[model samples]
Target: MADATTIVPLNPDEEKFLRALGTVMALLPRVVDADMLEELPISSTEYTVLVHLSEVPHHQMRMSELANVCGLSLSGMTRVVNRLESQSLVTRQKCPEDGRAWLALLTNPGWKMLEQAWPTNLASVRRHIFSRLEGCDVAAAAEVLQRIAAP
Candidate 1:
């Protein structure tokens, strides 16, 4: 392996790609959150949490696992869940199998909220992302993005 002190420079195209990726990483969430907040009662992060919970069995997931999937810290996830809980959209219960852990469970209201928000979310995504990719090979781009996102 090269020494840690060694300097490596990106080519112009690589530099441009990295800059664009960084911008998107910073901007996409804010744009989507704005759209979601305008037309729905929940922010993008909360919607994302609900979406993940809805996909799992019993509409529940361990709190830590939920945090991981949501890309939030445990404390951040707790705050978000607390908000959802306050709205009657989700509930938290101590894990039966692991007493020290907790689980976030989606409520009936949460499902309804997701259902109500789907169309707005779809329109936002299509307008902000798909609409701009008219001539691009989307599947190939998705594969590249997936590879980059892989752990």
Candidate 2:
């Protein structure tokens, strides 16, 4: 009987792509966590959640939608909202249109945080990732990733 665990070889392109992805993955967290956002008023998780809310209509998104946009689980988003609520960065409200749903509302403080974080964040991203790529290639890659992640 053939052993299912026998090695399955990756094609050259597959191996190359995985290596490229691995390199980026290894560098991303260290840069983002250490140099980019540590001094910011919000953690990356909080910032991403706020950014998602900031783009929503009236800066209010139902909790479930916020979770999907932020790549967070429902309970994770709830905890983030709880922390932001304590800091007055966000407000939690019951959805008027759906009594069972909760909405995440970006507050004035949250907007201010976003304002301060946005430029610096972009700079860090550029220095770490975008600046190294050819402009056209970077743009094309971004479009591809966006397409893959589209709802």
Clashing pairs in 1: none
Candidate 2 local accuracy as lDDT?
0.83
TM-scores, all candidates, are 0.94, 0.81
- lDDT of all the models against the reference? 0.94, 0.83
Task: For residues 10-70, write the lDDT of model 1, one tens digit per residue.
Answer: 8999999999999989998889899999987798899999999999999999999999999
Per-residue lDDT over 86-139 for candidate 2, one digit per residue giving the tens place of the 0 to 100 score: 889999999999999999899999999888887767777778877778556777
Candidate 2's C-alpha runs over 4 A off are 1-9
Tell me the lDDT of model 2 at 4: 72
lDDT of 1 at 78: 97
